[model samples]
Target: MSASSSVAAGRGAPRQASGALWQALPFLGIFAAALILPMVSNDYWTLIATRAAIYWVLVSALNLVVGFAGQLAIGWVAMLTLGAYTTSVLVAGNVMPPVPVFPALGVAALVGGVFGFIVGLPALRLRTFYFAMTTLGFATIVTQVALAWQGVTGGGIGIVGPVLPAPFDTIFGFYLFCLGLAAFCTWISANAAHSRFGRSLVAIRDAEVAAESSGISKPRLLGAVFLFAGAMAGIAGGLFATLQSYISPEAFTFDLSVLFFIAILIGGRGSILGPFIATIVLTWLPEFAAPLVAWSTFLYAALLLAIVLLVPGGIAALLDFRSRRRIEADRTIVPRPELLPEILGGRKASEAITLKDIVLSFGGVRAVDGLDLTIEPGAVHGLIGPNGSGKTTTLNVICGFYRPETGSVTVDGEPLPAAAPQTRAASGIARTFQTPKLIGEASVLQNVMVGGAIRGRGSFVESLLALPRHRQDEAMLRHDALLALRCVGLGALADVRADRLQHSELRFLEIARALMLRPRFLLLDEPAAGLSAEEIRSLGGLIRAISRQGTGVLLVEHHADLIFEICDQVTVLNLGRELAAGTPAEIRAHPEVVSAYLGS
Candidate 1:
């Protein structure tokens, strides 16, 4: 059945919050266990728990980069070591009187952020193993420097971290402090996993071009993530130094780097609590297996291999199997109509997009040659031509995906910044690709939510904190996304994964996503490439509806019948140059267009 028709029949109401509560029950149980264990455990066990808490903080931080952002950062230990050394040197060298615990923690965070920014700046440009190797180099350098810097770090011996103030001086107090800090870190990590920043990171990780087009700044967000993660790692390091009352170069080894790296892998990437649990188990597992001390390294290696091979998604994925099913089964959603006007009325005043003398070439081929087009608000302008006529290239240039070798693009009579895709998108241009560009793993709703990102709902900080602004923005985005989905007749399947969508559904979903942006202009590449005649008719109606909402649509399509039936104006291209420009009727009658594109 058609998704919307099924929705009208009331077949897809969202499931209750009970499903969500059930999913979270295990984590709540774990939290309760964590609290009670400290109260009942012996001193040795308590110490191990405390150490696990510290590593939990570090592992969670690393997860943001490796798990969420998909940046393989192995140099986090450097930040951790930096925090330890910075705190120890300050207190031990008497550079400052042994500050209170909170203040010491603050200092460690600052140290971590500073070094993290430095490392992230250069590393953001590289991807995959190259980035990993860069981080590995940074870790090596930091470890070597700690060993060599005798005056500051006490050479290989290392300086001592300051003890906590009187109230926290006892072992129980320290353990409590570690537990509280770990809990705070967990909260932040969990918040980030659902925040705008998190979504943006995942978008970038999955599709860089799509993320950029959605107005996400790759470098800025990544740098911020690295800085935040680094600060957290540093905090963990500072806490560890205080817990042990000692620090040394030998302690922060490449092996330590491997451990932190493995913790996230064994737990699962992109999960907040998964890595937290992995950190605890990995931290204490060796202590429990004291008899296998000599084989500990081999055992860890085996475990890593096992997790990577047998359960590549890690323990969290296994636990989340049921939750995944619940997510898939969730179709109980009410239609949101309030956001219709907000999305439809994208442009208040009349706006026009003008492309003048545009020329874009790749190597020796002139993809778009001296193309001039005008798109008026409240109109559909179709650009049609034979294969390789540069229809898509022209749209790319206008939307800032490709910079023209020599030309200018103006929106509402002002020069549009075509230097970056994000800039163009922010300036009221949104686009859909020839092939549907959607985050496969993300739900249909989430794919649309990405479009609403340009609406300026909240800041990164507000998103992370889940503040009122963030909630308000999220609510608005969700409402608008539903409206957009309904507009394209896919509201019933909003909860479905984008990858599971049929080709026709995907095309409509892409249009719905673009509409969520409430864009002044839309660059649509082949909206009817693979659709039935009925679907094409539906798309034409949707395009006209969008035009009525005052959105200027630049459609690059080959479906001549659909284009002629709906387009207010049409521009025909052939061999990188304009073949004809006029109303659909005029273009159809043009001799040159018929010979070149229409094959008369």
Candidate 2:
């Protein structure tokens, strides 16, 4: 297990490991059973298995976004719809002036991914219901367009899709074809859930704001999820069209979206086995419901309601439940004494984070009023005044979370934006919040993977397709993320959940994440405010090493004792302004500093 892909949890994190594989066994058995399914050999059974497998692929694709990433997607069927319709049009013998069928299917999937990317771009700006509403609108719009377009989409007439020429005609051949696609997709989705890219999705899903501040680009990560999910939906759709030997606008409707959600929830969100269970049960549901067909609706509704009300987190939670000790054993959080010094060395800095003519205001408050200052790169710079000294406000302005009213923030001539947070981060400015803003449910490795993506390549499409280049790039990022955790002395805690870490560890982990952006400069809000004396000294040293490496680091620490002991230079703020800037010794002796410290 390289650092980036480890499973994390321990101590405070409740037991989850024992249940994971125990639930997975059924899938193993099912796969084994499926091998014998083809042996049943009869056309009737083969066709049923084929249908189940096709839906299985659909469920798996939805799982990537809806389950693992925890994003509610109702429009998943849209991509599949695009794939089926595109394939129908291209192979219709009249559209596109003629093209081979297989290439058409491939083209259909690619086109679906492209369209899905367009839909997801808007998701970056919205969240929760707003996000869901945006996707739903997209689904509704596409359906209306398909319904209205008579010439290309065949209007309400639908489409008579092309068939596989010779080798793919029989049920056996078709079953094998669908099985091949389902198997490939299942492997892709499952492996991804355990890999760096998948971890990034989980991080974004868990908390977009924290992920962005930690150097993970929210737009790109979300887009990657959308593209991968879309490709899977497209692949499944094409197969469904082939299987039915026909398709229509009605085939991809609002209810299909609901079905996708139900499968993930019932199967277990974030579990590899969840989709399989959901798919099997759903594929056979109508037949099973046939016996009680009249009362079945009532019974089904009651059962689904019970499942939702009782096991809210999903079936994966129930199936993967295990004894506490076993769960603790799986996550390797520990003392990790060997890594302490390297972490300590990272803080001992010599330069300051400087803001010249910095200004910010809300209405007329002038929260930060023309702040002029420099924080020595490796020094513990303190911004202190009475209440609302604009300490936190200053941090926000420098990191680009808020646009300053005026003045430029320059770090060795690398100017920061007055507005855009992302652009500032790309220029090597990274920061943390007073609150530990981490994705609580995701593993430590996963959260850090989001941080590490700054160095990765390939847009959403390439990664979903598992192009050789993207795969290689992901592997490299994983290696780098692990190395970063190790540098901060959190290697053993790689698999631990961020929410489960000791408060100090969470603080360290945040800095570790910031480092993963490979920033030439770091802006730490307050790393020592919550730590003990030993931890404070450790923070001091860490700042120094980061400075020594030529990466400027600016720290705002409240603990003047720690600050004075470690900072080569210090700048103090009073009444929303820079009181003074100088070497630690000079400031400590200055009359104004003496008054500020003594409260004279």
Candidate 3:
């Protein structure tokens, strides 16, 4: 690494720490105000504040699901209902011997986590409105079950809430207890929101295919988040029951569920403080106008509509002044080939990525048929053909997005598992889409960081607690992502939102993201699609430089000049079959190749 690069890396540390602290300020201020509420407020206000605190405990975790992961879990109140009833019954000894208050709450949380996983299972196979309906249906069933199960849940008459012994028995004392738990919840969830797992969640929400290519398992990550969120909701329910001193099926209304979901939306997707503040505000709004309590759902809907119309990005967007700053109009992507060695230093793949007799068809029409190709390490191999010639399909097959009917894709001569895209990154394969698949709302730095998600050694628990291993993983990813951005001429816009970049810049941004993999085989699909002449020249040089650094380059492009210019070997495809394969010079002059693809 150059001294200048080291200085740049060093300079990023303090800035990142400072930025984190800056983000922390809002959360600190909110909790700090909650701490002092008892000193100035009366009993009624204190109770209201306590309710808000309890609600925040649930919202803090739900933010990870609805906000960060972008799952529409509208009926989360089911978790709350389950938690409330479970704690009430256990404390009342309705099903067995009486349990202590804390133990009852713990049991409730366990039940919630289990049920949460069950509720979230549908999300893996279902999408959007269908998933939302499933959650809503679950909430309905829980209510109906509570109403019918008279022996255990006390039916319509309801059950008494568990009261904590001493220090938390008094109204204000109980408020303090709830407030403390709320603060603790804030800390842990915030820790997760800033970790690699958090980034992967956002990536999964916004760019699932890209997330998968980066080795993010949607089922595993979503399952973990659902479990955590459900547990928190359960804890919140126990607290809510205690606050009310009674629990009933009527208490956990669908309207309440709407409020919880809306709070996250009003606060903004992928924001902790936004949802935190929204939770408090929404909880207090009904109390402020007593008549609004009856029409809470309507008011909530109105508020959400207003927020969407006035600020589509919600409270988070309003708070983000940094992104509103104007970016430079004149910017150029000057690829730094020297940095290639630093990023790709340890990546040494001995064998090529080979495809043997591959056959993939859709609706009996072959997309790739009887194909054989090898992407050799440290070489530029270009695949070119007319439209629907299976160039991109071949790339997809190699990336494991599509399974071939009869073939094998191997790395180091070991066959890659068919139909498993997430395993490709581990096999040292990384690729960019024909159209750039990126998390537009996230920063350029964050989007690039997504590509290195599999590189993190920390577990979800480690990230949730902000443990040493998680911190190390974060620092390593940040440094490497920065290095990637600098190499691809995107360092200046690291903090900028990806959607704000120009077409050409987005193209390079994809390359920057791909570099984060330190891939042994880098497959690019028409990377020169939207580039200017000079930009295309720079991209060609970067691709060639990456190939020279011991990474295999599979270039799928329509630009004949670029193919002939950067590629050492060229293969032309026509109707899912190879037309010609030779050195670029030989392919460029072949009579049949010129007539078929290069143009007469």
Winner by TM-score? 3
Candidate 1 lDDT, tens digit per residue, 1-600?
A: 235444633432244235446656766777678788867888888888888888888887778888878888876789989888877776665565656666777888998988888888765578788988888899999989988988778888777776877667887888888888777777777777766677778788887777788888888888888888888888888888888788888888676787788888788865776777788888888888989977766887999999989988897777755335534333322323343455675356656899899998889998888988999988999999989989888877876778889999998788877767888777778889987878776778888888777675677677767789887676667766777898788887877768777788888888888887778888889988888787788788778777777788888888899989999999988888988899999988898888877876
lDDT of each: 0.80, 0.69, 0.91
As a whole number from 0 to 100, the lDDT of residue 168 in candidate 3 is 96
**TM-score, per-candidate, Cα-based:** 0.91, 0.83, 0.98
Candidate 2 C-alpha lDDT tens digits along 3-122 = 323433232123434644654567678777776887866777678788888877777866877786677676777777888888778888545676677888888778877877888776
Clashing pairs in 1: 12-331, 13-332, 14-332, 14-333
- For model 2, how many clashes? 28
Q: How do these models rank on lDDT, best leading?
A: 3, 1, 2
Where model 1 places Cα greater than 4 Å from the true spot, the runs are: 1-23, 94-98, 291-301, 322-342
lDDT of 3 by residue, 145-193 (tens): 9999998988898889989879999998899899999989999999998
Reference-based TM-score, model 2: 0.83
Q: Any idea what lDDT model 2 has?
A: 0.69
Q: Which parts of model 2 are misplaced by more than 4 Å?
A: 1-29, 41-45, 68-70, 94-99, 150-154, 268-271, 291-309, 319-353, 457-483, 544-550, 585-600
Q: Candidate 3: which stretches are off by over 4 Å?
A: 1-7
